[model samples]
Target: MGGPSENPELWAFLESLHLGETLSGTITAIERFGVFVALDDGPNHPVFPGVGFISIPELSWRRFEAASDVVQVGQRVSCEFLQLDTWNLEARLSLRATQPDPFQAFADRNAVGQKLRGHVTKLVPFGVFVQVANGIEGLIHLQELTWTPLKAPSDVVQVGDEVTVVVTQIDRELRRLVLSRRQASPDHL
Candidate 1:
């Protein structure tokens, strides 16, 4: 776990790797935390089932219920080499890197003030999440929910309700979309 710099052989192996490099491997194990992969030409993990490790968030950009929803044992996969986990003596890989980011795609095709029709997916104290595009959910903050002040998003909309919204702000770097329902309403205009 602590020998990458201390161990010359491991250091050389790590140096040979280039970030963002594509690596092919077979999924060896899937646990609650992550998935392990035996890279076709990678080094031994020493303690783990495989030398490559993929954290749950790195598995995909889309929201999923479980790791099994995205991958399975013995499944072959191609992932981008993220970095070496010196603490675990394993290479961190990212399956999401192998796929196009839906957030980025959504931002590219849309702009602020653009009106979009989406279904309310979730409600919270602060805001509501609406699926504005495939795999893209934007937050409509409490203040943006209606022209009239409301204590909670539930007062304005509930999950499964179809609503029209206007893109008020888009944070590309943060992968966030701020929406406003009041602005999109014909009565408000």
Candidate 2:
């Protein structure tokens, strides 16, 4: 009954929202790709059920098998404005932006050659990605997986394995963390 169509003042207010604005809302809907929030004291969206929207990756810093792990319908949340999607004509918001960046946090607390332990999250042909912290993942390149020449990362460790590693590089601009498992264990060689 109440929406941008019904309230011109709300439409104008929503349209006036600038980038980087913080807004509070109730999660009205959840989709596989994103979450929709009906902003408090705001008008309904012209197309979406809510005026504020958050994409899957923007849901949280930590990886989860399901969106419900990050947010649920009817939950209250605050999000940072990302952009004004001209195509969909909706506000692209980032829920994660409101939260701390685990990647940056890890880097600030760690450095190259520092030893750390983490769980193997994913194993690719090139390397294995390890979860160094809540949402921070570091890659152990195939060459760094072992001191000896290895065929693949899987040969050294499987996914879900807990492994010790040394930080090799931290590219904050690119948000990348390179790690070395071989350097972490010299006695094993």
Candidate 3:
């Protein structure tokens, strides 16, 4: 209904590739959910050029405002094979896996207990999320929003507030960086 449907020869080709193998393709379409890739060396699907497909998180290592920021429809990309979406018969791929992670760039230059300034990106019931680095965020827990006890996170910080926070912990495995505004700010109350 969309691009093309599965055929016998195409099915045989798809069966030949193994997971984690590197493949080349052209970005044929970009949807809100992900980018569809037309493989240079692979067969086409009946519905899409999805011999390869890259999800939003798998598009790039940097924080991009949108998909167009990273690639265009005709752009070529070399991606690692993630898996085959059997239900849809699309090739699941990762573009970022081909390059270095920008989060590592932030980690390399920063450490725990260090004071850094960032803008509050979001305020939730649990904490304030701050963009300390491009695509990297640190959480200032509700209790850490101020030295004194607060009723809610909003009582201390609002969205888009430029705040200084101290790095409390960095969990690389989970890609989490914890921050404390209370530790960085002197108690005036």
Best by TM-score: 1
RMSD of each: 2.3, 3.1, 3.3
Q: Count the clashes in each prediction.
A: 0, 0, 4
| TM-score (all chains, Cα) for each model | 0.90, 0.86, 0.83
Error of 1 at 188 (Å): 5.9
lDDT value for candidate 1? 0.89
Write candidate 2's Cα lDDT for 30-145 as tens digits. Answer: 99989998988677766688877799989987778878888989999999988866445567889999988877888899989899999999989999999988788899888888
Worst 10-residue stretch by lDDT in candidate 1? 4-13
Comparing 2 with 3 on lDDT, the higher-scoring candidate is 2
lDDT by residue (tens digit), candidate 1, 1-189 = 666555556556666888999999999999999999998887766678888899999999988989999999999999999997777777899999999999999999999999999999999889999999999999998988888889988876889999999999999998999999989985862
Kindly report which residue pairs in candidate 2 clash with one another. none
Q: How would you order the candidates by lDDT, starting with the best?
A: 1, 2, 3
